[model samples]
Target: MISPTLIQAKGLRKGYGQRTVVDGLNLDIREGEVLAIIGPNGAGKSTTLDLLLGLRRPDAGTITYWTTDPSPHVGLQLQSTPFFAGFTAIENLRMFAAFYGKRLKDAQLMEHLHRCGLEEFAKTDALRLSGGQQKRLAIAMTLVHSPKLLFLDEPTAALDPRARRDIRELIRSLADKGTSIVFTSHDMEEVHKLASRLVLIRDGRIIASGSPEELLSQYGTASLEQLYIQLTDEPA
Candidate 1:
């Protein structure tokens, strides 16, 4: 096994200036588990992700991965960014894959392209691909190394329905293989569909964290979306 849990963050805190984004947060993402973070606008979801990914230093607290070998372990699919816009999709993967110090053959790269349903676009320049395609390419890069701990930010934000389904399936398959995931999304349905555990963030704090069913029953709400508004907006 890849261990019981892959990531544990305690009292995690991060912020800019006076605005504390992620405040005294605590999280435990286990191996082979899909944990999703759902929250309303400006809830510091991205900030929390940044802290976990080591993209930024926490204002207070610590994040440690549970593993025998700890070598700055984590992969992040940025919330929104054009990856290798000037290069072809395959070419971009070729470039990013090198950083992992693992050699994924050309055939393997093609498989990821195919998985993204972008096999036809393999030769297409990333800049030429549509917004959704670009996002898929970024996600493909993150998986190239098969990193055990992954932090995905709004991965399917602009994807069409079919693309969304494919990405969700891909994530599930990875988790099945013992990969841990921390996904952030504004799409309530997507979070519920893929997240084994859900953590709701509001204004830089985790307002609630539990299983999807637990959240529904706890709030007596019909759906996660409804619960989201109730928790964050407090229902005027």
Candidate 2:
């Protein structure tokens, strides 16, 4: 069965000076599903995410969450996650958990690290870790509070193939456990592998949206890459 809607946005519009970024967008983030928002650069994908996350106010729109206080149940992992200078990987997880007002035992903390494949780097300074390790650590930090809804921006960008595969598996596991994930990515293969549904946007408007198979069939395209190219190509 489909899960309940965890967040709803209607007619979201945001702009800077004379330029609009997110224009007349509507979205629904339901529980226990993975939703990917994809688009070319400058297509307002990130702006749409910010509007839905409430990090930026829209010029016109309304956003509603399942609960009145959604922060306790939400997690956000931006592309760049800054860790405290001296905190180790495990320490960062503890600190983030405390931000949500929860204290985790060592076993619990280790479990989070283990899941993200960071247990070996538990005591390593977060900043000292390699780029991919830091990325995984950031994801671990988001899970410390066991949030019901997670927003990941470019979760697997720039990682080596193995790291990317690991992160994909992690996302799949999270969805299996019923966490609603909203992520943005340029990797169509990752999108095809992970997204139960997706929204494709351009110039701040949705151009196409549906499950991978659904959109592919609707457009009569062989794959998502082909569909993306077809829909996003400039008109002659």
Clashing pairs in 1: none
Q: Alpha carbon lDDT of residue 224, candidate 2?
A: 92
Residue range 37-88, candidate 1, lDDT tens digits? 8887788888888777667899899888676554436667997765766789
Give me the overall lDDT of model 1. 0.84
> How do the residues 1-236 of candidate 2 rate in per-residue lDDT, one tens digit apiece?
86799999999999999998888998889988899999999889888888888889999989998999998898889989999889899888899899999999989999999998889999999999999999999999899888899999999987889888998999999999989999999999889999999999998988888999999999999989999999999662
Q: Which candidate is the best by TM-score?
A: 2
Q: Which residue pairs clash in candidate 2?
A: none
TM-score result, candidate 1: 0.92
Worst-scoring 10-residue span by lDDT in model 2 = 227-236
lDDT of each: 0.84, 0.91
Candidate 1 steric clashes:
0
- Residue 21 alpha-carbon offset, candidate 1, angstroms: 1.3
User: Which residue segments of model 2 deviate by more than 4 Å?
Assistant: none
